[model samples]
Target chain A: MTALAEPIGRGGAERASLARRASGWLVLALVLVSLASLFVGATGLSPFAFLKAMLAGDAVDLRTKVVILDIRLPRLALGLLVGASLAVSGVVMQGLFRNPLADPGLVGVSAGAGLGAIVAIVLGGLLPPALAAAMGYALVPIAAFAGSWLSVIVLYALATRGGQTSVATMLLAGIALAALVGAVSGTLIYMADDAQLRTLTFWSMGSLGGATWGKVAAAAPLMLAGLIAAPFLARGLNALALGEPAARHMGVDVQVLKRVAVVTVAAAVGSAVAVSGGIGFLGIVVPHLLRLSIGPDHRYLLINSALLGAIILTLADMVARVVVAPAELPIGIVMAVIGGPFFLWILMRRRGLMMGL
Target chain B: MLTAETLTVRLGAHEILQAVDFTAHAGEVTAIVGPNGSGKTTLLRALTGDVAFTGAARIGALDVARAKPWELASRRGVLAQFTGVAFPFTVAEIVRLGQASGTAGAATDLTEQALARVGLAGFAPRRYHDLSGGEQQRVQLARVLAQVWEPLDESGPRWLVLDEPVASLDIAHQIEVMELARAFARAGGGVVAVMHDLNLTAMFADAVALMARGRVVTQGPVTAVFRDSTLSDAYGCKLRVNVAPPSSTFILPHAALT
Candidate 1:
């Protein structure tokens, strides 16, 4: 037994170090990407000059201050929050369902939030004038958050019975829900005039262009709350990878884990969608890439997903800002373009595993 | 001792398990043997509190159904027949999940020892998905072992509730696992295994419970329960029990005449 144990001790140590190294590198990458994002926008304001001016307490130009502080700073912060929320939510959903393909967008949570935002946009005029005026710009996000919670509640009700949740049922129900919500959103779009149609188009296509201090302030608390709650779920999610029965046997309250995970995903994604629109693929792609590089230990995976998700989204937002120069491209288009092919590659590589689906 | 009395399970309109009484003593291996659909797995589930059942089940002094999951987890470990993991997890990571029951101190050392005991030394870094079916089963067994690494705690004895643990292993590995069970029992732990291979069962199990159609046909010490008529009637076939030297027995099923 001693002879057999010798090699394992070395291997276990090596794997532990490897995970540590991977996490270290991901953190470094996130910091570098964030710094680069501050300088890579269309306004041509050098981050170095801005930093130097601010540090020296010298007179700074108004355009540079507005570009850096007003626009880019809030945008960067929103990108980080939204990205981290979506990615963490994706990790939770995948672990909860015991399937790699589970994502907030694919599972209809994002669609539900999008519908909520659209309803607020299209129907806000119907509210009594005083009430609509009082809600101000906060109405869309509030409505979107409410919509997200409602849809998740409905989805949970449909997918779970007798303390067991069926992943297949959840996925199918998500697809159906997406279609139903899309139809309603389309009807709203048809009723809208040209200006409302423009707002709807930009919102649906997904962009960080509209990021503002108010939006960031509104969404950050919910996203932060969800992100903080995620690490506590690491152990339960890890046990769940072995399947529900084995997870329960490991002393994890599987039912409670499911409830917490669903609520977390909904709150995070709902707040994100309310602010950033339906940013596709970051949730799915970030966690998938991290799992490929590092093993599926949710303890490390959740943190790394948050870091990498933030990095990737910030970089993508930079691309969306610069690729079209004076005219910005939607961040959703950028993510979908990169993520769609990567998703296909993962599917092809894991074709045998997908057969079980 | 782990005890279950008047356990009955109903799913929809069908009864999966009828009223059944089971008792597995500490420091012994109890094997439940039966044909397919004999409710062997369901019985294990009920005992582990994985499924709702109308019965009284207790491990030591705590009622299984009412005990807190984490509290129960510290005392009992379970191995399911089929375990499907979605992401790529290393064997070590999978084994370490057993520490979720709050066995944080010494968990790493115990995980390594557990893997070594299952003949999977140096497999800590190996991906669980890349392993063969038998290897994965052993990995799961290693996880179970890590969960109950110490056979006895402040509590009297721990329990290992397994569902068809060796159904996927090769012949040699089957004996290896059975030997682990025997060793565990020797160390003063309770092991209740749902088994299909009667030869292995006869060799390793101190007590045998034979079941047919959701009911225990007969249960007792190995020698008394391995009688020819009881097994033959329960299995719906002709079986002859051959007693071998060193107090072992083997059951052979006779072929039907054309």
Candidate 2:
């Protein structure tokens, strides 16, 4: 008997226990960061000032109140929603493919959503900005959902038959689709006039520049829905990590499972892109960090991923504001800079993980 | 009671299983043995409904191919080859999944008991992938053990199907798993396994189906499949079979007889 298997399993158990313990810490961290969001940047307000302005709405500067109430609050709310959403989707996506490298954008679902949002921006330009925002945001997710569904459909159509989905083939299809759609997005940029190009460019790189209460309102439910639904998937995913035939012999309905996993991932990731332009790294980072911390038990792994994603993004976006002072860095840029390196580390170290390791 | 009748599995244009007929009543172990690509796994998969095939497999009164998956799952528990190694699942959790084949409360308690039967009682928290190949096989057997170990329901008897369950196991675990399967049959459940080891098959299997190139060359008691003529015919080589003096049959390859 290899001592490694038991110890490793025990190690996973140990980490799961640790994750369960740190879970409270992460929740506290999010709460503290939520409070910190109110206090961060240019306000020069003491925590008391921040709290006073929030409770009484009688700050000396109305702009400070506006900054806290209108701007920061919505941003915090959207950041939390988008972060948790991406992270949950990432957990589901990586678990489904058993590939740690999989991310909404890396696999092109977000790019597809990006393309949808672009189309809405360009096509909806005929309407007013508010209407265009409504149409573009609405259509972004619908388009992203449609696009993601299409990519999944194509992947399934090409690689799956006889009730089997080939992970390798689906991944290759995602890579190929990402390149093709990315090229289309680039072409959309080239075709746009300078004015249109600016929004398109920002959306392309990803941003949380438009976190209205309305957008947050829209994203929160779907994000919450995904978060709530994720833990139930843990057992099925655990069975699946065993592989198609083994799972089947063990009496899992493999085809039904794949369908549920893909659709749920689409719903979670799609709604996220609707609110936040194309936040990168959150999805990939959340699940990988959780997996590293908690092992592959989807039961614990999924919930931990959600918590970590929420915490990391909330903190990241807060830092993005303070890093540059009054001129805020688009959070998409911040996440990419931080998340890109980690992505490389995962990719580089992944040969040891050929079987979705 | 479990039986497969006229089961034909077609792979593209080639027939992988050509009208294979087999049966195992509760209280017996049957080994489906053959060389690589000899339809051993194909037959087993077909019986488990892991593949679509043109034939009928019945567990008691329910036609296995047509039974609702949940219905069939309760009646027949299967453990295929130990190929997939997913990290992070403790030995207990994997076995717990097998308990899903039983009543809710019984599932948990039986899973614990099944692990102990395979000499892995204390290994509940061990990572499944971290185990050596043989130990992993034992754990998987523990899972199937949990599955079929369900006390009989009023509806149907439980069936155990394993495809190359011991292929990756070492000598000790091999005997452990085989004995476990044998005990399942003795306990009034049916166990049908596809095995590569003729010696082990001879030792424990109540009957054997010797297959070659998708056809059953001979199907009978263990004594019939172990004969010199059938052995030579199945392997396409000159072979010798001799009974050892230890009060049981022992087969040696011609190359090892020195």
Candidate 1 overall lDDT versus native: 0.83
lDDT for position B238 in model 2: 56
Candidate 2 wrong stretches, greater than 4 Å: A1-16, A42-65, A121-146, A157-165, A338-356, B100-113, B151-156, B240-247, B251-258
Q: After superposition, how far is residue A172 of candidate 2 from its true place, in Å?
A: 2.6
Point to the candidate with the largest lDDT: 1
List the TM values for chain B, per candidate. 0.95, 0.92
- The digit string of per-residue lDDT tens for model 2 on A26-107 reads 7777898888876786455577865675589664477776777788889888887778888888877776776666676544
The candidate 2 chain A region of ten consecutive residues with least summed lDDT is: A1-10
Query: If scored against the real structure, what TM-score would every candidate get?
Result: 0.92, 0.87
Which pairs clash (backbone N, Cα, C closer than 3 Å) in model 2?
Answer: A5-B130, A9-B127
- Which digits, one per residue and each the tens of the lDDT, describe model 2 over residues B1-258? 788889999989999999988887778899998778889888888888877888798888888787776677777777877656555566777777677644424623665578788877778776676678778877878877776674355664578888887788778878888888888787777888998887888899998889999988888888777888788778877567778767466566777765
After TM-score superposition, what is the CA distance of residue A115 in candidate 1 from its true location, in Å? 1.4
Each model's total of backbone clashes: 0, 2
Among the numbered candidates, top TM-score falls to 1
